[model samples]
Target: MASLPQALPEQRAVGPVTRPAPPPIARVRRRRRPSGEPPPLPRQLRASGKWWLGLSAAVLLACVAVVATDTIRYVDVADTRVLQAIAGIRSPGLTAVADAAGMLAAAAVLHVIWLTDLVLLAVFRRWRHLLVWLGVGLLVINVGAAMATTLQRPRPFEVQVLGDWSGFAMPSLPVTVLAALLVSTLYSLVPPGRMRTIGKWLVCGLLVVTAASRLYLAQDHPTGVLAGIVLGVATPLAAFRLLTPNAAHPVRYTRSRPAHLDVSGERGAAIVRALQDQLGLVATDVAPFGLAGSGGSTPLKITVKAAGPQDDGGSCVFGKLYAATHVRSDRWYKLGRTLLYGRLEDEKPFSTVRRLVQYEDYVLRVFCDGGLPVPQPLGIVEITPEREYLLVTEFIAGAQEAGEAEIDDAVIDQGLAVVRRMWEIGMAHRDIKPANLLVRNGTLYLIDSAFAEVRPSPWRQAVDLANMMLVLALRTDAERVYRRARRHFSDEEIAEAFAATRGLTIPSQLRRMLRQQGRGLQDEFLALLPFRLPPVRIQRWTWRRGGLTVVTLAAATLAGYVSVGLLRSPL
Candidate 1:
């Protein structure tokens, strides 16, 4: 009786009381703007080229004004005094040292240094930096010659010239070329940071030695040496800073793949901010992930903080970073493919980083909507407007590549079912290699949809099926995979799949894996089939391909000729 106390009137209810469920957390979806309409770049990210150029211009104008006005006499007098002082202290040893320093600025020495830089840059595939270096060198030489010709000032008066000299003495060409060469070499080869900082001071020290030696030998006036130093260092430093910024084209000595962008330091901080502001994700960490398997773009694993109570702590997401280098790589890749295998169904390169990211995001959404077992499509985050972008998606946790995971019958069926679903939806993942397919708790997940094509050709779809089967068969025997595949695909379809697949059709990764298997798995699968078809001809000739072939050969020949001429030209 005591345990069954009557309910108070205030707490009584006509029926079972039900509290309203908490409102679902509202997620804000960022509306993607057209690529052409990206927000204006922030002022801080704008290149500092204009400022450096202005400073150089001011120096040039000051020198010209001084020489053009009555101030020329004062500069000449000062130059004479400096040379006289240098001569007054000259000894046999100091004079010999000055002669050696003059030789350091010799054209042959500069040529050797320039050629070495070219070779190193070419070897490292730093084509952009190499081009910048060459262009800046030409500009500095031409500009220095023009300025010296315009001034046409004579060597120091009443000072005996002791070293070899050439050209007008107002702005010494040797000193200018030496300064430009040393500065450009440092920027082109040395990475930006403490090392570059130290390299800069070393370059300055060398420039001082050359300038002072020129003054010591009375080969050029002090004003001429100063002008040469200013012009030589400023033009290239500004141009390189403007054209080949460290943010886009980092200089590294590692032989690793060039497509991977450094995901640490300033870039990492930028990524965290972009994710939080643009994609509404509080990213705590961003690091390179699966870089060994990826070649086209940098892969990153980003860890984000939980948003609300429903979230199960923090979660990891996958990101693919695309930049201008990747864009160029895509162009080169497509061009090579066209030249080698003739227009294999839409081999056109993406026009920009934005378009490349947008295409992948669209394909991901389409696949997800079509009920594919792909990663959930997260929004794209802009890292540097049109120059760089990051495509985000859900990370399939605890997943191993299909080749590494133990493939049971269920895994085999799931792999086949992925292709079946793609066929039903008129989609083809042009890259169906082992690295792109992930297995998690027996579920197969397809990734790297950048190459996936919607409404693809039948040949392309067939190639996809073949690639997937080869991947699955690598884990199990071909017979088991074939038997499991038949439940999802017809025998004729499977035959067509193999028929459409050739060496060129298979991705490089899958091709290499098949070679390693070495058991003739492809031939075994062909034997199990009731009927056979000839291997599809992948090399289709086209006028465009022929024209590209001709142009490419011509360009290569011209480049070789130029390189040889540079190497053989007189010092």
Candidate 2:
């Protein structure tokens, strides 16, 4: 090859020596449109998108402020006793506990967002949708605080609260904040599917514990806590609607069979549009279920039978819808205030919905797994995006008539068996009743375990029994029911167990109240609070069934009491 001749500077300049061929002309590919299809609208052009972005940003900013402000004021006056006790016993341990709890909360929040975004992006592969949810969660905490403060709500502490406390009373800030975090986290992390059903129950249980912890610790009032949950959950959900895909046509179901679709991953608005479009096939003639009871706790059952070719009426699946009403103030909105008093949402006592849904789910699942008779738990479903309605498993065959007739001798026996089984496993069906103990195919099946306290002590165990007796008393003559229950044991034995487990007698006032119904039940239950108070649990221990020590803790004491009472009673 001939040696390359050196090019003169002039020649090189002429040939564009310093420059190169213009960057390759890039081509943008346009998505091909199907014939007759309308042109796709830009995502940002939708009105809902604007609202979604705005609402989500507002919620996120609020949450950050609440967390930061609360974190800065680290004193929790309500838990002084518990804290002092722990610190006195183990200095390092107390410090570690405090540090760990704070770390855990922070980690949990971050992890929730991360996992939420990961799942949403992975499933839908949409960045914008993920952003909307992240924003909604971030805003929920601070919004909860602002609302709580605006309301001038008070914490449940009987003594002086530690920090700058100010808020209206209604929705609880702590409970609501927890609810917001949990709902948003679950909504983001888990896709609505077979697995989601279990996850939802677990999450519900977790939230209940959180709320109860707050109440038990005397951090916030029950009403305030519940209010917090409402605000925390509702705000994000409303924002989610704004972020819906079809801005003009949000997801809505009225007298229509809900269609199962991939509503997970996308912004709330998108999910709404998808639901509306997919479930449009449902007949408008079918009347949907409505909300029932105070606090919007009770769910209405909706049965859909197939009338068309696709309909096989005999094999139709039943759906339940839990409805929600707007409350003025909610608990989760005042999270910062509650936390200042050493209150965490999970510590509060279980709510009606909490019992119906969370405890019911756990009881059913655990009993079912233990080979006990239970209604088939098809799974819990969300009727709306708002996290208000929760559907539990309803029996498909042979609906029984409602009334005192529902509580017959056979039903009572079954209830005893069920309670006995629970007791044997070191569990207490805290709210045992004729309604909760359903009769199916002549077999008595336990239904609601909402307040069931598993692995309870003698006191807790007795109170659980007392609650059952109380319920039984409502349906039948108290003396007669007491006599019949004595057949399994003696009156004295029952009383002893009752005393040992619950620590006191049912007040005459409460007894008279039970006869009145409704408010009576509420008052009676509340009155029994002194006896059934959840003990100040210093420690919690989990043990295997086979462990001897566990067996001793679970059964020995209760068994000894029952055995001694039986021996003392006359035949």
Candidate 3:
């Protein structure tokens, strides 16, 4: 072997094998711009400026009028007769006239704004704007009344036989009108900016000037004028911001659900059969899961099946039946046909729950149209006047009710993302407890819209957000849980939500028991610490600005505070 190596086998020269270069990438062709098309305008700039201009002009006119009137008040030369006449006009008679004039003027302006809003809605099909306008009008009325009560500034000195005068003197009617007009006018004309700095400044300045002019004109005292402006200014701003842009508020319940009698001698079995037949539910084949709830309440059975005929006789789909006995004064067996065909909610008046379900049905449809992930509603059927209500829906298989501990950090992260999407769409769950939130095959699903209201009250929205926070807080750090919620909601909103659920009952007694144990827990925690920041520290940190996330988290914190207190307690 060594001798052969020494001979050095003629080294086979290896040539560098060359591969052909990849074919030149096909060039991406640039899309040609459409011929002669103008660039699109920014939405903010496209908003009409006419209202702003008109408001500016009106303010100038009012200023001029005030100055001219003041000059007249001081410069008039008066003999005894002239003085007497001037005094007569300035007396209660003239005061009454001026007051009436102010009211009439306010009414006229309000009517004009209303008509303009209606016309705009009709032409541009912007109902949201119309709602804003209506809300503004309501706020103005409230402010005006409050101003009159707060400021008792009196009229100019005058004497008249049988004269009549009333209302506060400081903020002159003209000045109040000017302030309201400017605010409302600007709101109507200006488009919403991400920050709205210019509009905010404009409103602030208008209020200041209106108050100053009224005092200078001697129509109202400085205090009265200031009070009126303050009142007026506060309302519109609070209402405008609180209303939430583009929120579609459903009609409030005007009347209670009517209590109708059960149909005479209706049998529970017969009604169930009739409904099954009508809805084409094959109740005979499937095994049903039965549950008995609070007494005088219904017994529910969940049954699964497929819709159409199957050769193999195996179906994966299911339906739920809610049946309850309807009791009369005589304690007769008039099987209550009242059945909840759909999901349930936290403790609520039955009537309210029904309304909520109806609203949710419509809202879910809306969400579907808008491309949001929501459970598809098949249909709802009422079985009887007093016995049962049934809802047919796509049963999410392998879905599990989220438990307190199971809904940990990961679940919360995913759930909050869904929450953000809901807020962006101007919607809230109105009920965010674990029961309503489902995890099916590892995907979080929002269910149980029986208490769902589209664009609910601020309190309601907060409660909904808090409910979710409570769910997360049960298994996670309170601080971190709230921080996550604030990424979508504000502190004030959170506080409000907590306030709403103050007296509400939880579905689980364990939760209630923990809450009961946690009374004065915040104080106890404070006492235990050597030093402590304010309880609202989390709120301040999260929602000091109007950030959506902050507001959302604020809600969550309140929920978390309550939830964690319950969870950590020695049960």
Candidate 4:
């Protein structure tokens, strides 16, 4: 039995207890950039003004204005004087040097360089960069031709035309083509750094020599050479800077995957600052993790500083860095799928990086609320509002991939149960490969839910179940896993699952694994089922599909025509 206790006496305050003022709320200053504004320029482009496009347009307008007005007389006089001065110094040796330079800057030599660049870009799979290069070259050629015809300025008449020439020479076509070729090749091939810096100076020197040679040979006016340089360098430089930014389409000779963004240098520092300011999570170190298994977004392991004193140094969180490149890749991927399978599911692409990250984060929260074994969503941190984002989540430490782990009865059940839960919740983990499944402490975890869908198609859900079962059977016997699955799903459901499962439905990683095994794993699983159902037809054509197909074919044909024209163009 317990006894009641007595009351205690009260004591007076020793002194007025002082309370320290709360620490000033730390305020983080964010860049006041508008959402529609482009991403911060890469380091190589930082020194240039943001209005380069406008500036180039202004220069072009000025050139046109000078040609249209009487001011052209003064410019022509200056041009003639400069050509005469160059002609005065012409000697046999000088003439020989000028001829050699003319040969070097000839249209044929420039076209060869252009062809080599195209081949290299294709071999390296730099498709975006390749497109920009082609577009710039075509634009320069067309614009230079039009401008030359409009101005109708003849070759310099102050001296003898020592070199072979043709057509009006307001903007020297050779000089323009040479400038465009050099600029495009440098930006498309050389990685941005000290090497590119040296390349820039060398390119400038070559351009100067070519322009001087043309002037010495009395082939082009000074103003014509100047206009050519301006148009050639400005147009492509602006286009490449805007379209294939170094941050997204960096030129590198290494074998690193393009999907994996470099997390060192400025991007790394930006990540740390963004996490601290936006998410209130102080990240210490950020490094890529499991790059070999990811192809969509760069996976990173972020070490976070602990908030409390009792914490053990720090803990790590997982992050997926999504950029403009990923957004483009997603669009191309969906377009390919739609063209191939005719809209199997909701194959719409996200409009922006923000939307992409938002959808994934929302899906993660939904799965977490529904009691699925997915990573807990830690809010998104925007590195660049619409251009780039980072989706952070709980890092499943000490977990081995399903393919590498010991898949026992419990592991198999948990894996099957995940699909059951997803089905019950009206959700489907569209990607259910061995790489996305993890086993730790006898519990299976599902990750990489970026492709998970809500209220997914019945076929899609069936495919999910089939994929999970196939993954489980990879380690254990098909009959044993089927027997365990029977407890959660019915025989008819299993049959439908296998029926929905096809070559395309399987994730790429799973398909590769199946091929490597050289065993009929999918067929074995199908045999264990009570009965087989007819394979679902995935291809269903529609007006949209037909239109898209036509457009794709037309675009391909245009691209081929442009390629051939580029190789054979008479600059």
Once superposed on the true structure, which residue ranges of model 4 sit more than 4 Å away at CA?
1-45, 49-58
* Span of 10 residues, lowest total lDDT, candidate 3: 333-342
Model 1 stretches with alpha carbons more than 4 Å out: 1-51, 60-81, 150-157, 308-313, 561-571
Candidate 2 per-residue lDDT, tens place, 1-571, comes to 2222333323211110111111111122223435664322223434533554455455445545645676312323434444344234444554344333322123345455445555655565433345555566556655555665554534534343322223543345445555665655554445445655687687667666655444443345554555565566565556544453322222232432212222223323332232223332121122223221112233333333234455344222223333222111122222222332221112233343333455557776776665455555545543333433344454434534212435666555555555555665677664444444444444555554544556665655655556555655566545544544544543333554444332123433334345566434333333333233333332233232124345455665774564344223211
* Model 3 C-alpha lDDT per residue in residues 277-355, reported as the tens digit of each score: 4445443333332121122222223242343454234333333333231122102111111111111121223333234
TM-score of 3: 0.35
Off by over 4 Å in 3: 1-276, 285-304, 307-360, 363-374, 385-387, 425-428, 490-501, 505-510, 513-571
lDDT of each: 0.80, 0.43, 0.43, 0.82
lDDT of 4 by residue, 1-571 (tens): 1211221212111121122222122223444445665433233444352455555577579767977675877878888888888788889999999999877568678878888998999998989989999999889999999988888878888589999888889789889889988998889999999999999999999999998888889888887888888888888888788787777778888878899998888788888878876777778899999987899999999888764555566777899999989999999988888888785753788999999999999999888787777777878887866788999988888889888888999888788778877877899888999889988777788899888888988999999999999899887778888877776777778889999898889999888888888768788877776568898899888777888899999999999998999778777
CA RMSD of each candidate after superposition: 11.5, 31.4, 25.3, 11.0
Identify the candidate with maximal lDDT.
4
Winning candidate number (TM-score): 4
Query: What's model 2's overall lDDT?
Result: 0.43
Local distance difference test, candidate 1: 0.80
Candidate 1 lDDT, tens digit per residue, 1-571?
0112223433311221122222222234544546665342221424445665676788788767975784777878988998998899988899999999878788789788878999999988899888788778767777887777777777788888888887787678888888888888888899889999999899988888888888889999987887787788788888777677786678888877878888887788888877876887778899999987899999999888765667665678889999888988889988988898785653778999999999999999988787777887778888887788899888887889988998999778777878878887789999998899888777777889988998888889999889899999998898888877777777778899999988778888887888887878888889878788887788888888999999999998986776665545332
Taking the candidates one at a time, how many backbone clashes does each contain?
0, 66, 34, 0
Alpha-carbon deviation at 280 in model 2, angstroms: 19
Structural RMSD, model 3: 25.3
